[model samples]
Target: MKLFNIVSKTTLTLSLILFSQNVSQTHVYAGVENASPPAVGKTAKDFSLSNLNGKQIKLSGELKKGPVVLLVLRGYPGYQCPLCTRQVGQFITSAAKLKSANATVVMVYPGTAKDLNTRASEFTRNIKLPANFQFLLDPDYIFTNAYGLRWDAKNETAYPSTFVIGTDGKVKFAKISKTHGNRSNVKEVLKALSSSS
Candidate 1:
């Protein structure tokens, strides 16, 4: 009788352990139903991603300072996107103005999980980013899907998008560009930042 009791208790403990493991392993991303950008006035979803230097950057943490201008680039479609390069450069030129407006620019460089670090480093080899700007990598489109910005089309990685999230964590402006050359420009982003409360 004592042996039977011990065996039963052991089985119960094993079952509890398995259940806890499964519960804790709940997936972070379940993919998006549609590829629409988060609506204006909607509370932005919090996401954490690794930067070029392997440092984790969380969107909510950056919002603690002020507004955040999120740039989602078309990452590793085939070669480096010239349009993306130009867009990044344009924003970098106006970095000081953006800083004065109390805005944090968070650029998302997303691509496949294979050697993405190397690709991202190559993307920013020469251009210098200001202190208020952060370069984050979205490996395997994890962050993109989380924000509903994944452009899962042929020869495309992510939809070139821009969003302005206020300190209140509400999206003030959102733009998703389906084509390569029609991305949001720096003037519009700065304007959004200035208008954000």
Candidate 2:
């Protein structure tokens, strides 16, 4: 009887451990498996995410002003993503042209809620964003999941993505990179903006 009791308890403990691991794994791949990125010609979903200052920036509101350039960045996956930095710098350099195109650049940094604001601040510490640019934070990947742009892998926050939305709220161009380096360039976005118009 004593040996049988010990075996039963051991089996129960192992089962609990396995169950917890499965739950965690499910969370890691959550949002990406069932959804695809928004396709061109489709109406992009409107979402409201706050910048570091906690002011909400709504997609529909931006669209009302003019065309919108939406960028999904990998937010604080252990550290600031270097590729995101370079891509944003490219956009900053071409901000004047983007403005001439009457496009509002909305960059989304998605990450866990804890320390997300701090991480976002650090990410933008060295850069001077243009007047037309808005850096928004997606705490707990709310926007990423909503857009189906979540990378859903180890040490990754989001799949780098860019979308050019026309004033009509239709997506004119959409690029989602599964790899880290193939980000949308400023020229490509500019072309998309021009074509969208």
Candidate 3:
């Protein structure tokens, strides 16, 4: 009877351990379900991330100068994302329009820690960033997670997102794209920048 009681207790303990492990795995897998996309009229969350030059750029600091157009990019997912490249090029083409409307453009490239700096520098190289534009690196996706843009699992970096922040430090417009191809265009962002009151 004593031996049977000891075995039964050990089994119960093992079952509890297994149950805990399952719960933990489930929690990790259940990534952002009901999170609504960030919207206009909300205060855009401020972040300070390092640039390729290792300089810290703050979102709030940019907003102090004028409105800001923020773009989040996927970085180094075993290959450069062509869709991100195209969207970035479009923004570059519209630089004048964004600046004319008193807006600073910032592109964030997020990647894993191993190659974040190298990849971010490579991504921005030779691109003519206007005086009002900056490229930021979200190493290990700290800022991405803060903004709820982290694509949980499958080795994904982050979901593409754009925010138009007003000089008043509030988000004037926001577009969060779930997939690769459905990002906000430069024209639409320009319109929002121009129409911001």
Residue-level lDDT tens digits of model 2 in 1-197: 99999999999999999999999978865764566678999989888889888899999999988999999999899989999999999999999999999999999999899889899999999999899999999999877887888887889889999999999999999999999989899999999998878
**Which candidate tops TM-score?**
1
Stretches of candidate 3 off by over 4 Å are 1-37
Q: Residues 1-197, candidate 3, lDDT per residue (tens digit)? A: 99999999999999999999999967853553544445789887678998888899998899888998999888878788889889988988878878788889889999887898887777777687888889988888777876788887685788888999898877888888788879999888888887885
Candidate 1 yields a Cα-based lDDT of 0.87
Worst 10 residues of 2 by lDDT: 28-37
Residues 1-197 of candidate 1 have per-residue lDDT tens digits of: 99999999999999999997777655433336553467899988888998887899999999999899999988888899999999999999999899998999999999988978888988999989999999999999878877777777889888899999999999999998878877899888877877775
> Candidate 3, clashing residue pairs?
none
Please report, in order, the local distance difference test score of every candidate based on alpha carbons: 0.87, 0.91, 0.83
| C-alpha lDDT (0 to 100) for residue 135 of candidate 2 | 99
Q: Worst ten-residue run, lDDT, model 1? A: 27-36
Better candidate number, 1 or 2, judged by TM-score: 1
Name the better of 1 and 3 by lDDT.
1
Ranking by TM-score: 1, 2, 3
Clashes of each: 0, 0, 0
Scored by lDDT, model 3 comes in at 0.83
Candidate 1 stretches greater than 4 Å from native: 1-27, 31-36
